[model samples]
Target: MIRHLVLFKLNEGVERDDPQVVAGAEAFRALGDRIPELRFWECAWNISDRPIAYDFAINSAVEDTAALQRYLEHPAHQAGVALWREFATWVMADYEF
Candidate 1:
């Protein structure tokens, strides 16, 4: 399986605990149920970076890189990109074992 991980930093005016952040977290957590190619999805918030925890994160498990690519191009995900424009920086990494 391929593990697709992502993290985000919100725009300057956005609060870490804002409703948009909360909603995005929930939406990501629900992707597994909405997308057939998604084997698993996890969403997280309020991780303490000072204590070694990272920013908001998503860990998606897919059957292969092709499946992950499909997920990346999905319309639903595109919609999310629009809604999440307030995010400042987004980073992603993939690993397979």
Candidate 2:
């Protein structure tokens, strides 16, 4: 099993409170249902880690890193990333067992 997580901070030019950000989060949450390899997925808008520098985050679980790699290269993910880039300023990550 593997846990892959990413955190995104949208540019100041984009609205942090925008509905689409929320929508995108929900979209990510729904991917586990859409893609079988994804054991679970969750997207969050706020974090209590007050000193951190991320605006939003995506946390997902997969059967393995191979599944994650396949998911990363999938067309649906490409489409989703394209949509996500519109609101994202910088994206960061943390991946592990």
Candidate 3:
């Protein structure tokens, strides 16, 4: 399986409570039920106030590279990405276990 992890940081001047940001976050949160490629899914906002901390995170598992690719290319995922692009940036790491 592949574990796909991502950390997201909101753009400067963006607030967590902002309507668009909330909608983007909800969009991501809803993906586990909407996408079958995901064997596992978890997303949450960061509670840390540390400067090095990201504002949000996604921790998910998929069957393999193909499944991962499908998840990446999925329309729901793309929509979530488009929404996030407007207010945040992200970094990710994928590894097999």
Candidate 4:
């Protein structure tokens, strides 16, 4: 299996309640139902108050590298990414388990 993790930091001055952020987060929250390659999916806002904490996170898994690739290329995923690009920047890590 492969674990695909992502951490997102909202752009300076962007708030969680902004319409674009709300829709982008909703789009990701729905990906488990929309994508067939996902073996696991969880995403949410960060609860931490630490200065270094990211604003949001995605914890997901797939069968392997190929499955991960499909998830990345999926149209729904691409759409969500496009929306987020306007309001946030993120970092990611992927590894086998």
Candidate 5:
């Protein structure tokens, strides 16, 4: 399986309650049900107060590289990414397990 992880930090001055941030978060949350390639999915806001913690996270898995590719290319995923691009910076990693 391929595990895909992403961590997002909201842009400076952007609050969690901001409409764009909320919409961007909801967009990612909905991907679990919208994408067929996902074998597992978990996404949520960070509960930590630590300075190093990211504001949001996404932990998901797929069957293989091809499945992972499909997830990344999926229209729903693309839309979510587009929304996030406006208010956040993120990092991602994918590895086979």
Candidate 6:
């Protein structure tokens, strides 16, 4: 399986409660049902307040690189990425396990 993980940090001056952030989060939350390649999904606001911590996280799994690619290319996922691009910066990692 491929494990895909991501961490997000809101742009400067962007509040966690901002409508854009909330909407972006909701969009991500809805992906599990819409994307068949997603075998596991867990996206959420980070509970940690540590200075080094990111504001949000996405932990998901897929069958393989092909499934991961399909998930990345899905229209819903693309929309969510665009929404997040407006208010946040993120980092991701994918590995086979």
Compose the digit string of candidate 2's lDDT tens values, residues 1-97.
7887787877666765688766666666667677777777877776565766677777888887789888888776766677678788556453667
User: Tens digits of per-residue lDDT for model 1 on 64-86?
Assistant: 98998899888777666666666
Give the worst 10-residue stretch by lDDT in candidate 2: 88-97
List ranges where model 5 is wrong by over 4 Å. Answer: none
Tens digits of per-residue lDDT for model 6, 1-97: 9999999999999998999999999999999999999999999999999999999999999999999999999999999999999999999999999
Clashes of 3: 0
Q: How many residue pairs in model 2 have overlapping backbones?
A: 0
lDDT of each: 0.75, 0.72, 0.98, 0.98, 0.96, 0.97
**What tens-digit string does per-residue lDDT give for candidate 5 at 1-97?**
9999999999999999999999998999999999999999999999999999999999999999999989999999999999999999999999989
**How high is the lDDT of residue 31 in model 1?**
72
Q: What is residue 23's positional error in candidate 1, in angstroms?
A: 3.2
Error (Å) of candidate 6 at residue 12 is 0.8
Q: After aligning candidate 3 to the native by TM-score, how far in Å is the CA of 43 from where it should be? A: 0.1
Q: Give the per-residue Cα lDDT of candidate 4 at 19.
A: 96
For model 4, the local distance difference test gives 0.98
Q: On a 0 to 100 scale, what is the lDDT of residue 88 in model 3?
A: 96
After superposition on all CA atoms, what RMSD does each candidate show versus the true structure?
2.2, 2.4, 0.4, 0.4, 0.5, 0.5
Screening candidate 1 with a backbone cut-off below 3 angstroms (N, C-alpha, C), the clashing residue pairs are none
- Cα error, candidate 6, residue 10 (Å): 0.4
**Candidate 3, residues 1-97: lDDT per residue as tens digits?**
9999999999999999999999999999999999999999999999999999999999999999999999999999999999999999999999999
Indicate the worst ten consecutive residues by lDDT in candidate 1: 46-55
